[model samples]
Target: MPVLIAIVAVGIVVVVLVVHLTGGSHTAKIANEDAAVERFLIDYPDVEVRQCFLSWDRRDAVLELEDGQVGLVHAVGVNFLTRLVKRGEMTARAGVSDESAVDLETGDVAWPRARMHFADSAMARTVVALFDKKVDTTDNKRAA
Candidate 1:
């Protein structure tokens, strides 16, 4: 009986987790993307941002530039990126490098790199949808 009860409890927990992960509103997801783009702009004011997609946790972002280059920006948290900016450690030209790699000349900090790692497939789909919507909108405007 105890084993049956434990199995039932585990099943219930799994169901709840699945529902919570998949039940977020579309508007909330778009708002998250907007906030990430805003944060990226604040951190890299000189870079012309064409589009951006943020991780579910908002710890990382993928920025598309006007020049058609895509790059990743990441930090411990949103505020940490600002701190790096203020400390003169971050620049528009800073090349992304592995977390384990060291900058030979700077010697103090590793070169920051931009990369995307989605927490789940749902989040990845949301970003793709957003990108598609943006592209569609741009195309429509160009036709007009």
Candidate 2:
């Protein structure tokens, strides 16, 4: 019984160490993205936020708009991802075959170009739904 207790205690310690090092699981990542999106919406209430694609490390959120525009919002400790969004220079490419892959351009000379990919089809669908809901709500409010 003593041997079993020691093994269990070691296992718990290992689990705790792993969680602490890795900063938790995918659910935690989703939660971080949710909070980031909320903060972004608060800052830009009138801007249509279609979707927020989380970076692999969950430290940044790439926000997609209804008109195929995109922006980035970084965590508190990170540097600003780009100034194109702030400068209103971000524009979608004229033609693109794959809906999942987006080519972004900034008319401004200082802003760098970027390509964003939404590899997950389910996530793409979810984004579409979110955009549709926002558009519908805005239309309803305008009509009233």
Candidate 3:
């Protein structure tokens, strides 16, 4: 009986350790992007949000502010993953087609530059405030 009890205790300890190491289940870590948008709307009632779009593959969100500035709220380090891929992880199934791999790779390495134009500094500030609420800012200090 003591051996059986000991076995059960060890099993429980192992399960707890695995859960802690893995940092919880994927579902708990995953947030519904739509819910995030709703939260933004609720939080910033002053800003008239035009649109909110979420990335298909990841949790990046793009929100259009009332003053016409498009705010990009993304996981800060998500781009690092793309950078790593561009550094030559292009396998046969890395979405590289024979017809356009070279061109695609060149574009990947020299990613297009994006310019952010705000109507005024205040508008920029409001957009940024909304963005911070939406994005997970812990990964990058630039979010601060």
TM-score of each: 0.35, 0.37, 0.32
Pairing residues by index, what is the TM-score of model 1?
Answer: 0.35
- TM match of model 3 to true structure: 0.32
lDDT of 3: 0.41
| Top candidate, metric lDDT | 2
Q: Considering lDDT, where higher is better, how would the candidates rank from best to worst?
A: 2, 1, 3
Q: Return whichever of 1 and 3 wins on TM-score.
A: 1
**lDDT by residue (tens digit), candidate 2, 97-126:** 656544556464654554544555445444
Better of 1 and 3 by lDDT: 1
Local accuracy by lDDT, each model: 0.48, 0.54, 0.41
Better of 1 and 2 by TM-score: 2
Q: How accurate locally is residue 101 in candidate 3, as Cα lDDT from 0 to 100?
A: 15
Please provide, for model 1 over 20-71, each residue's C-alpha lDDT reduced to its tens digit, 9 standing for 90 to 100: 7876311222246566666666766676767665665556665666644444
lDDT of 1 at 33: 56
